[model samples]
Target: MNDLELGVIGNCAVAALIDRDARVLWYCLPRFDGDPVFHALLGAPKDASDDGVFAIELEDHVHSWQSYVENTAVLQTELHGKQGSLRITDFAPRLFWRERLFYPQAIVRRLTPISGSPRIRIRLRPRFDYGASAPIRTYGSHHIRYVGPSATIRLTTNAPIDFIRDETFFNLRAPIDLILGPDETLQEGVVETAGRLEERTTDYWRNWTHRLAIPFEFQDAVIRAAVTLKLCTYEPTGAIVAALTTSIPEGPGTQRNWDYRFCWLRDSYFVVRALNRLSAVRKMENYFRWLMNVVASLHETDIQPVYGIGLESALVERTVPGLPGYRGMGPVRVGNQAYEHSQHDNCGNVILGVAQMFVDRRLLSPPGHEDFLRLEELGRKALQLYDKPDAGMWEYRTRASIHTTSSLMCWAAADRLARIAGHIGETQRAGEWRSHADRMKQVILERSWSHKRQSFVESFDGEFLDAGVLLMTEVGFIDPHDPRMAATVKQLEKVLGRGPHMMRYEAADDFGMPGTAFNTCSFWRIDALARMGRVEEAREYFEEMLKLRNRLGLMSEDVDPKTGEMWGNYPQTYSLVGIVNCAMRLTRSWESVT
Candidate 1:
């Protein structure tokens, strides 16, 4: 009965997912796309031979509860056994120190007794190179180092070394600290370092969330979603990952699983947009720098749909056969092949993502004339290929179409560049960009509209309906009040909506058909409905979508609409961004409270 019911804890450098029973099921070392140190999440079915787990087994545990410490990424899980009860606090140390962000690549766990004496067993098994090799364990007086083929990690703790080594049960009389991090000795005592980091990390998150201008309604859900999105961001390179894990299937045996641990420019656009709406501009600022580097590196090459977190352009896709996939499905992909595809919409997304930085006066390092000049290159590229064929946003491997999604985004690119040029006093440049946008708009309107289907089709002169085109009103490409906009929404829901959840499309692609509902498309539907003045209907659908989230108010990339079961990658950044965007759109204004 394994599911995506998991809690995430990270310091933006590293992240891990812990199940309801407090097992660290998924974790990557050093960085987000690095070797998975804990791979139990994609291990053998039923965890039959899971050698990548770090679990604390209570002797007679019967019940448990898990949640994030309010307004923070710190996770608190309590376990109740026949003998007694205990609480586990998990977080990666992150805080501000010496005027710099001091977020180490570490996972800190503190065990505290809650009731009568509870005994627990520590099972610390780590793997390397996608579970291909096991680590050799060597113990010191107060630490145990797990040495792998290429890397090593040490568990510096105050707990008894022999008890952890032999997987023996120990009494829960007081608090103990266990820090898993770089293979090095602690500068301070284990207790002092963990305690100091815990206090500071908790403070850091609370202060961060407190600054967010969240909607009055659904405040808790919005904060949680915002925190999840931030955790998915790699602070060093400022590249935001699509999700934390790889190879979680979109549907049972669909073999639709793909690695989501890298940055997709398209997804990054939505993530920063949502965060910007909440006034959480730090992410956008970091992303602007990352995008700057990405753009600078695109010398004589077309922009990729995705890139490695470290800004490495060639993300050669491959499978890791050593590890069985989620629920026994195979083909655990590592790098994303979308890096090789020509997704034309990405240029528009990049422009739209950074355009705000030009207008916002508050950004510390606003883009200057040079940055705008760099973006104009993307604008030119978008206009050149706006009507041409590519994979589209869905990343269809076998087919290429003049996708309306691609065209609309290119239109967005031209549109934003024109506006940016005007704001920057480049009137002549603005006029030229404006003409490019207007011409593309007319062509898109003429070619993408389907009189036969009574709606806007997915691609040029194509009748297949797609959820991607629902962005007409979202990116300011079209007014919501336009008659065609309403018809488009109606037709999309008719063909793609499964109950309240929306599928990416009804048309089949390389995978035959998409079985599960794409969560972000459903949120887009809510957005379209709200903008069309169907506020009540949008609120109804939004609530329905919220129910689909796990107990921790977290969601994945897709879900089983029929059974309300979550599928796909866990804690998807796209899905979390949806929660923020929809809540922001639907919630009542704070002035109403007064």
Candidate 2:
């Protein structure tokens, strides 16, 4: 399926999903949360088709191969036919120009013939209002403008405008450049401008990648994951989205799809941590600003689980009626309603993210006393809410449990705050924070343990085993060598682990059974095994999980255990974070590589 065979190109401003054959299947304009200009990834049905897709299809398509330019977001797709072969180099213009970051909300698709003549057709179908209406088209000598209900998109190309407008086939004569961007007239010729931008963009990315501190093993995979994480960041606000796409189902024909094009405190925390390991501190600095603004915007101490990339608090989830779901699955959702849920893990996550600013002396400006004081507000909230029942990390709507993971994060928050207070010379405050952490840990240790289940249950006094508890050792809730932690890991593996994959939890949520295994949960198990001195087993498991990644070494949020098909949103940050974290923990010393 084209959905599985996709590569992404972006410039931290906007992104597009292009299939193996160099077709722009899905792209939102202006920003990640903006209207879908090319929405064909979510096909209409078997009977009809959706507009807003850009594709250059060869008459007799034989084979295709796609890959990213090394250490860059640029993608190259090669298509072959009996007649001839063609290559399309795609990228969004992002480079240092005039001593400033020049990132435009545009996609550059440069098509060149490699062999003999090939017949090709250009289909530039753009819709507006989330595929609700088709755009009205008008063309000139070298440009075409599609005016939609809300915004207009212009396509400037060196190719014949008549052939493109009429969707007619033409023989490959020379290289053509198509610059699809905001509704603006191009002053320069297409080929010349695009050629310069491509070279500059390539240079810019290579320079950025050169600065990363990657592990010895899995260097290529780590670099790709790092670049993908950079693309997910919204440079304007420094808010990193959970994923680029809105609603790709977690499982086939299951209504478990949810919009992920928003900032989640928990998810961003892991993202910042992963980037920190790579020494990509610029993203952490930008995300710190985004986090501070989110904290400032909240009226109460209760922070929502998720927010819009622009820090818009009211992310009321709703279904868009027009466009069919990914693979025609239905009920395509836009905004996520998880914002309304009170996930107690949020405050702890924010503190954990902020704690880095205080401790990391390598940062340009290490956090001071004032920053610590600001974080104390969240620490207090975590101390108060950790034991109370809420939606938990999974964002369950039907039932609320005093989730052990939530309680454990509460302890982590208080513990970090206590340390931060000590760093700022607030000994009295440090002691108080430590007291709160100790109290929360006591309650969790006493209440979350189940005698009959022989493990730490999902929630207080419950028999359900959640894969989330597999993080107990990683999060410092318990020592990896502790019997209780070992039992919890073994029990979770029995309940949630299917081969190498692990489910977040087997218990039914607002939906029914989860169709696929959560990607990060399995990685946590690997980390736990390494910490517990099971290094060889952890390495074996880690390698198996790595093999499940797509050809581009990218992963989605979930994977069907039965089949290796990836599900959920494309190139999810959580899945990528797992790759980086596992690689770091499992890699040998840098001295060996040296």
Q: Using TM-score as the measure, which candidate wins?
A: 1
Candidate that scores best on lDDT? 1
Q: What TM-score against the true fold does each predicted structure earn?
A: 0.98, 0.97
Give the CA lDDT, 0 to 100, for residue 288 in model 1: 96
lDDT of 2 by residue, 228-253 (tens): 99999999999999998877999989
lDDT of 2 at 360: 78
Poorest lDDT segment (10 consecutive residues) of candidate 2: 43-52
Q: Which run of 10 residues does model 1 get worst, by summed lDDT?
A: 43-52
RMSD for all candidates, in order, please.
Answer: 1.4, 1.6
Instruction: Give me the displacement of residue 259 in model 1, in angstroms.
Output: 0.4
Candidate lDDT (C-alpha), each: 0.92, 0.88
